[model samples]
Target: MAVFKEIFSHCSDLVYRKIEIEGRQAYVIYLDGLIKTEDLQNHVIDEVLARKQVGQLSVEKVEEEIVTVSAVKDQSYLEDAANDILEGNAVLTIDGHNKGIVFSIPGYKTRGVSEPDSEAAIRGPREGFIESLRVNTSLVRRKIKTTNLKIESMKIGVQTQTNIGIAYIDGIVDKNVLKELKHRLDRIDIDGILETGYIEELIEDNSWSIFPQIQITERPDTAAANLLEGRVAIFVDGTPFVMILPSTFWQQFQASEDYYDRVYIAIFLRVLRLMFVAVALMLPAFYVAVTTYHQEMIPTNLLLSVAAARESIPFPAIVEAFIMELSFEALREAGVRLPKTIGQAVSILGALVIGTAAVEAGIVSAPMVIIVSLTGIASFTIPKFSLAIAIRLLRFPLMILASIFGLFGIVVGMVILLIHLCKLRSFGVPYFEPVAPLRFSELKDVFIRTPIWMQNSRPDDFVKENKKRQANDLKPSPNKNEG
Candidate 1:
């Protein structure tokens, strides 16, 4: 008890209860907000106290008859006992013994699983991951009811002692990827990791690149699908988003809805998103370049209207684009930070009022507003928020380039960006796999959402031995008539 007190000194919520168990003096320690008191009292305390009434009992008898917790373990070290208590497990210590029994009963308030606010889908399971790591892991377990699904856990963050779980299939996952993931995780020497983002930044394939090497999702089906495809998932306690390893460039545009919806519609939507990503990257740059330097790129009447609009505006075309783009981005960030009820209203109203006032005040051209609005819309089409954020970061540099050298600068930026992407790798897998390498078989799944029956192989660079995903000749067809 003294050692336990020393370890958790100045913590007011540390609770201890003394009782005689089987004629031996015993004390149980736990955190107040962690364990469910009702379960502790009814399931454990009552039975142990009853055993004391029997007068004669042994450790074997106590183990056989008393504790109701299914996941009880003996802790020999004082540090282990203290750690278990902090993890919401009640430690029962007998007098004159250097050991304690730790009960697994983690109970505390957490957000309930619901629709993911960031990764909403039109046609897929609406359930999203919550802050509870156990609940999130169970969500994936329920989806993929295979014994091969393995979830290994480790504690990171020396001060915070944050729990991290790694999920992967045993035989299907590549051994090299799993070994690399464990090595990287073991190297994380942070003092605290409050969210999965911390782990992402710490263990990603590349820290310098703006493009995210790790894939994040709040949906269990998406995580389960990734696991089935032989990717590892890292679930950080107290965060809804789970990080999947070795994410490729094409995977960012692909959403969980692609597999849930009709193949044709999913393919069409995926293609549209691909186009929108390009637009998000280049729209404002194109607008700045054309209106500023290459007015001939625009037709005569449109150019006349653009010139007339700019005649009233005091700022240059590039400055006007900058003003509107930055304002829209500000509105977006404000919308995300504010409360949901007023957030949407605030962002919408702010953008409308600002854009209208800017144009009415002759600060920006009307055409610039339309182009900026379209660019924002295109950015929204990106399925992954991380990729959308990457696009947002890249836009400023591209805009600066366009403002200097016109369309040529945009082309140069694109070329450099493409080269950077090609040079990137995520855990030995090419970041631009199935594209720059041009694997014809993998292209079917990368560019387009092939029919499920036709997708017979797993994605490249993910699974080593289990390359075959499904049997061939499963495509549906009508039988021949006997006329």
Candidate 2:
């Protein structure tokens, strides 16, 4: 521990304040900014120093009076004291004693609860996660007050010492899943982990895969929902996004509000989103394939119209498609980087202006513009922004293949993608869930959400031990005789 402290002595963020009271010197230590100054002054320091009666300052008495003190029954070791300081809990050490008190006055400033930017819902709790880990955990705890809601805290990243919590319902969560999650996290020997993404990269089943195996969301409700469903959530101290482990391909398309809305509507929307994903990922490639090689596939009239539109264009079909796709991607990127107020306007306007100018200048054809626009719109339907971005990226390679070898290329690309998806896993669970493994019952909640009563079990992919979500006979039927 001393060696660790010596190594980080030069770190500007590390703070240690030597405090002396009544000829007895003590060390008041904490990570700067991690603890509140006012609490330290009023609750800890004031109470300790203002002990007017000298006869009553024994260790037991000190433990009794300090209101903000966390642990009194258990003995506090130097290692625990150091850990407390690292985790934003202030520690006060008396001169002679090896033990100390930890005050849980985490004072780090964080963003106030606001609607999640990515997983926004028209109805339901608008609160999203903040940078502070305690506050975020509190939000989740506020929703789930069960004793089974276990939060196993671990500090990873030797240098950063970031607090990461693996939270789940103890009895409901599969023991194997929990063990695997812990094993992977323990193996992550990085310098620092500032965000959940860092841990995701380190612990993910397939690091090389483009698809994200772990689901990350800013919404606490989403994390809480997963926790209830027997999936473990990994929370990194500084990041708004909390990662849910054992993510299946179907889960990425799911939004938090699905359970809140009408079951029929939810099912419809889920199906729509799935359709949109397919369209988003393959539409551009299919367009390029048809226009460049499979001209016969298009109706004669349609082909003539497409050819007439492309007549003024000097570039080949593939070149024209690439130009439009690249421009659209650039516009999307710029819009995202810009402030939200003008971002949408800029992206929409830029696409309109650029697409019009390019078509007029004979750089791209009209049919290409329609295909790219549809593809962009389709990609937006994806609930997860990261997944949508991945689809957008995959489009380029698919388009390139289509340009080179047409429909055959598109088919080959999809086959390869499917094979890769099959190979990928999330904490050892198959990534391409219900579809690949063919869990017919779970499909009710995957491709389309079944009516709430019908979804009698949690996803079996994540937790094998506790599969039942509710009961088998929860269907609500009207009394025909009464009616």
- Cα-based lDDT for every prediction: 0.88, 0.83
On the 0 to 100 scale, the lDDT of residue 227 in model 2 is 91
TM-score of 2: 0.91
Write one digit per residue (lDDT tens) for candidate 2, span 294-354. Answer: 8899999999999899899898877877788888999999999999999999999999999
Instruction: Give candidate 2's error at residue 23 in angstroms.
Output: 3.7
lDDT of 2 at 195: 86
Write the residue-wise lDDT of candidate 1 on 1-483 in tens digits.
888888989999999888875556878899999998888888878888776454444344455567787888888999888888888899888776666888887778888789998899888899999999999999999999989999999999998999999999998899999999999999989899999888888888789999999999999999999998989999999999999988999999999989988989998999999999999999999888888789889999988998988898878877888888889999999999999999999999999999999889999888888998989999999999899989987988998999999999999999999999999999989999989777888888776888899889887689879888778889989999999
Error of 2 at 152 (Å): 0.5
Q: Please give the distance, in angstroms, between residue 269's alpha carbon in candidate 2 and its true position after superposition.
A: 1.5
